[model samples]
Target: MTVRSDDTTLEITRVFDAPPARVFAAWLDLGQFQSWIGPEGIDCEVELLEPRVGGRYRLVMNTPERVIPVSGVFRSIEPCRRLVFTWGWEGDAIRQSLITLTFREIGGKTELTLRQEGLGSVESRDGHVRGWNSALNKLDHYLSGGARR
Candidate 1:
């Protein structure tokens, strides 16, 4: 995994030992998403999921201390290629950000790139880097047939 970040944006690239279609399907599949979409050791709940453009979704991550609720609307979806969405914490609408994910096929594997912007501060961007890296690691493990959380 590689992560790059500036003052208000973050980019991550990772390679997964799965095809692009399977990798892309993970994001739209509520069951698969909840299994690997949070930091390691965190539990996730899918409150709502609508994978089409203009559709809304909600997820809750349960940490040891508290539950963090996140909500989003799908902006675009291109099967096996790309996805774009708006992301924000449930009660913090003003801090909404945009996330774009692109998947490319390489030698039967998937190269996934994620770009996120509109963070309120550098601290927020850094925090997302950590969270996303952990989440991606979990996703890789899941794709490799590891036990689900």
Candidate 2:
């Protein structure tokens, strides 16, 4: 996406204890999503949120010596089944990526799948894969009542 002409894709899968509706709600709610948007050590703060399609959302991830800004516009919202949004990391994700998240119910548990596309290079793709894995793992713990301190 960035200024580059090429595009890449990244995908990851994880399971959450909650139901699809609940998980979707967490994503839809600014406060809840902020509580679990980043890696274990990174703190997230919500700035602006509009969850419907064609809406905008913004958040900041604070870490050592840096504040990462993330902004997105929702492209699709399918209740408990799917969500599609454009993701930009203030200065980085600008490389161009549209992220899609799909939630499915399996035996009362929710399976979450993240698909990111339109990245321009391998480095950006790798960074997103790592970032998504960390975020999703943190979310898994959060949903399981980790009592994170």
Runs in model 2 deviating more than 4 A are 1-7, 91-94
For 20-124, candidate 2 gives per-residue lDDT tens digits of: 988888788876787688776788888999998899998888889999888989999999999999988887745657988889999898988888888878888
Per-residue error (Å), model 2, residue 71: 0.3
Weakest ten-residue segment in model 1 by summed lDDT: 34-43
- What's the distance in Å from true for residue 44, model 2? 1.6
For model 1, the local distance difference test gives 0.93
**Best candidate (score: lDDT):** 1
Off by over 4 Å in 1: none
For residue 143, model 2's alpha carbon misses the true position, in angstroms, by 1.0
RMSD of 2: 4.6
